[model samples]
Target: MTSPDSSAPLGVFDSGVGGLTVVRALRELLPNESIIYLGDTARVPYGSKSPDTIRRFSVEDTQFLVSHGVKAVVVACNTATAHALPVLQATFRVPIIGVLEPGVEATLAADSCERVGIIGTAGTIRSSAYQYALAMRKPDLQIHATATPLLVPFVEEGWTDHPALKSVLKEYLKPLLDKGMDTLVLGCTHYPLLIPVLKRMLGNKVRLVDSASTCAAHTQRMLEEKGLLRTVKSKPTLEIYLTDLAEQAEALAKRFLGTEFGKVKKATL
Candidate 1:
């Protein structure tokens, strides 16, 4: 395998369009580094899948990105990261980073983060990846985690402002709020899109730690440490791919990526 140079694009993959949030963050933090994103839209919700299946899909996704000569791979999906990160790191030579550790670090770094609440998909919550990581770092921290399976579909459907979404958010967050959580960790990449709504509901008391931005920061540090940071001052590029393109794929991608969205191609693995 050819070693990726500094100019090589960074690879990011998710179970679906939600991963674009990480792409957006990376674009803001490291504008000179190009990126290639892959969304496994055909099997969109890896959240409900078994650990073995998630691991298998993640490996295929990494292989696709590595084949394209990415300097490193970012597992932008929380479910994939929780279940498959170890396998991916063990199997791949290129640097493989995930959203879980960055999110845990960010959560711990928050001011007065004693009582923490984590929200993500069923697979992520079930895996105990976030909870264990947090506990390992700070044994006394209080961590409450729950699966918010509905939010991803709601966001993908472009229903961020739907009244039902707010209701669901309230219902999903009530227990954590009642527990007096001072910091909320958006464990899934998709959860970043709901920051405004979350802030409004949780008010100024709860600090929100967005995994996308934290993961991007972690990626930047890893690149710099490895001497793979792109130093060119030219315009950075973004390429998007989806295993099964939905009619609303571009719209959803735009929602997650904001103004950094671009044309998305169809990918097969």
Candidate 2:
């Protein structure tokens, strides 16, 4: 593949706004790099969908990013990473980064107890991507994965600290806690919002691995390695687009971004 223009924007996408966490990280690490983010709000939960559907949506998302002159593509959604990463990489000339492998590596590096727990959407947990990656690296590693589908909606609603959210987290995490997992991988992009609650529930002893941070770090390294890192030190642009507008999406974007998003536009794809 041809080398990308260093000055081009990087593309990041998810089923919805959760991918902004990855954007948040990228902004901190690569402040000079422009970023284009797409939220497929029309179909917010790719986790429950079939692999074929996820692949189609991922292709469309990548196409939109490509049209915008993105230097590389970051699949910030765990469900999409689990199901459609390979296809995306194969079809696109630009470098493609996914959240799963980086998260798996981080979890393995942080855990000495050989026990890892993963919490994601149904599709992610069901894909066994983390389990297989960990097992391949260390055969004796023990993994327990659970699908916490409700947490996504809770986050989308900007209800990270709601009592109902805590109750749901408790119920969802009880099984992994019982399994004596020493490290918990926040397998969904939206999951980092619950870190405070997760820390309270899982305590200081259990490490929480955020896929968004890992993915961003990975993107930085990959870009530098490929000589695609932008060198200009000016203000980087951030453009947010959604396929369908949700009433709460703008509010959640403000909360996630820690600033007003100014305006959100609709995407044809």
Candidate 3:
């Protein structure tokens, strides 16, 4: 509950392994900055959960990171951002970021296009979070959305490109393609793990967007503005924690993180 410190690691959390997309982006954008990541594997797939449940889980996740002394926190889960971000920003002392705001900003900044498509989990789409944000940015923009709930489970299970994946992705994205969308936002963090398949399916005509990179960029800019940039003196380690330490979590997460690190030790809540 104190101010962000440049010397501290940035905290990133999501309902599950999907947050690695954000961590990967952070590593690329701010190589020197230390990072701490948490995956609530015990409560994976917040997309189907109730809003109050998402809020409670998000609060616990944020507190876990704050207690560990992170300078800033990023809520990488779209469901959490849709339901919990405002409360966290208002109550937390340090600067807090979420995929929703930055993602919307990035989507709106795309070349003036009329037709936009959004693909995410059922909860995210049902919340109408992206639609609302898009409306605020461009009231006249034509936005189409469909929930791709299975992709998260598939990605979480490390099934990025099984033969079944193409069919699943095609079915999930057909609505967007049918809407004549020139741009598509992968609104769920886990969706980025399937970017290669998505890009292939969506092709060059439809721009595929992942907010992780933009979110990381925004985090770096915020820290720079606050003079909270970290100077690395040695190998900065990334500490990970998970509510449930399933072996699959470790195996699959490494793929998204682009590394072979083992399972995160269970967090002490």
Each candidate's number of clashing pairs is 0, 0, 0
- Choose the strongest candidate by lDDT: 1
Instruction: Give the distance in Å from residue 242's predicted Cα in candidate 3 to where it truly belongs.
Output: 0.9
**lDDT for each of the candidates?**
0.92, 0.89, 0.86
For residues 1-269, write the lDDT of model 2, one tens digit per residue: 56689989999999988889888988888888999999998987899998899999999999999999999999999999999999999999999999999998788775475788889999999888888888999899888989888998898777888899989988998998888888899999988889998888777879889998898889999998999999887778899999988778877877776666657989989
Q: For candidate 1, lDDT tens digit of each residue in 1-269?
A: 65669998999999998999999999989889999999999998899999999999999999999999899999999999999999999999999999999999888886578999999999999999999999999999999999999998888777888899999998999999999999999988888889988888888999999999999999999999999999887887889989988877777888788884656799998
Per-residue lDDT of candidate 3, residues 1-269 (tens digit): 35666789989999988889899999988888888899999988899999898888899999999999999899988999989999899878888999988888888777767898998888889889899999987989999999888887788666788989888888877877888898888898887778888777767898877888888888888888999889768777788888898888887788778876644789855
Give the Cα error of residue 114 in candidate 2, in Å: 1.1
* Model 1 alpha-carbon drift over 4 Å, by segment: 1-3, 260-262
Clashing pairs in 1: none
- How does residue 112 of candidate 1 score in lDDT? 74
What TM-score does structure 1 among the candidates reach? 0.96
- Estimate candidate 1's alpha-carbon lDDT, on a 0 to 1 scale: 0.92
User: Could you tell me which 10 consecutive residues in candidate 3 have the lowest summed lDDT?
Assistant: 260-269
> Once superposed on the true structure, which residue ranges of model 2 sit more than 4 Å away at CA?
none
- Please provide TM-scores, in order, for all candidate models, with all chains considered together: 0.96, 0.96, 0.95
